[model samples]
Target: MGFWSTLFGGGSPQEKAARIAAKAEARAQREAEELAEKAAKTDGLFERALGKDPENCSYDARQKAAIKLVLANETAKGREAWLSISRDYPNELAHALEQVGVCYHLEKNYRAALENYEAAIRVGADAGHLADNMAEARKGMAAIG
Candidate 1:
């Protein structure tokens, strides 16, 4: 119908297949680049998070490692790292619990998310943010049920 379509043989099955394949390849290339970029950043973050040695990791390093794991989508590891020192640092504990809840929510584990949020509240995290997160987790759980 259009001049460009006519010139490009828009009705041709072979042309459509070629275009689709090319699009898919382009998408794959973009995804690969994105993944590589994410890996590079995560690697740097992990290195910083493990400063000195494994046996003598600092509190700051542990905190950073928890954050890094969350960023890298290693939710379980991140959650554990956060929980490990949560009691020692109430503020951080609250923050960590809230973040872990968010990660669980993203993974569609609404029960875990709700549990984390509740723990955050119990640990006296920022009341405002924790309350909001708890409400959201509850909503997510309800939606699933």
Candidate 2:
């Protein structure tokens, strides 16, 4: 009966299910390709901003690159860049700590986020600017607990 129905131009139930599954597979493949392309573009931009030797790059250039990476949703790379800055330029430690906290917050690691935020405050980052971020991390921690 299903074969006869299919021959008559009405797809059988199995055929309809297969068609839906094929469409879903195709959509998933396209989405994966798009994500890969986006990641490649972000890497290119990060390299351009930071240059080949990021360690030797000017502080401003490294900071710009780190900011770009973070804004592009590459939080781990951004955090590393910020850490390098803090290590090489002690004067910028407070700001770098705060940015690292933000990256941790974005990653949903609330405990790490809070710790970095506190360290930033201790290092003289403006408390007023960090207050909102600290509160949000605390809220997230509370929700989890």
For lDDT, the strongest prediction is 2
- Predict model 2's lDDT versus the native: 0.86
lDDT of 2 by residue, 101-131 (tens): 9999999999999999999999999999999
Clashes of each: 0, 0
Once all C-alphas are superposed, what RMSD does model 1 give against the true structure? 5.3
Q: Model 2, which residues run further than 4 Å from truth? A: 1-36, 45-56
- lDDT score of residue 144 within candidate 2: 95
Q: Clash pairs of candidate 1? A: none
Point out where model 1 deviates above 4 Å.
1-33, 50-81, 84-91
Clashes of 1: 0
Error of 2 at 130 (Å): 0.8
**Could you tell me the TM-score of candidate 2?**
0.69
Give the Å error, residue 72, model 1: 6.3
Error of 1 at 122 (Å): 2.1
Whole-model lDDT, model 1: 0.73
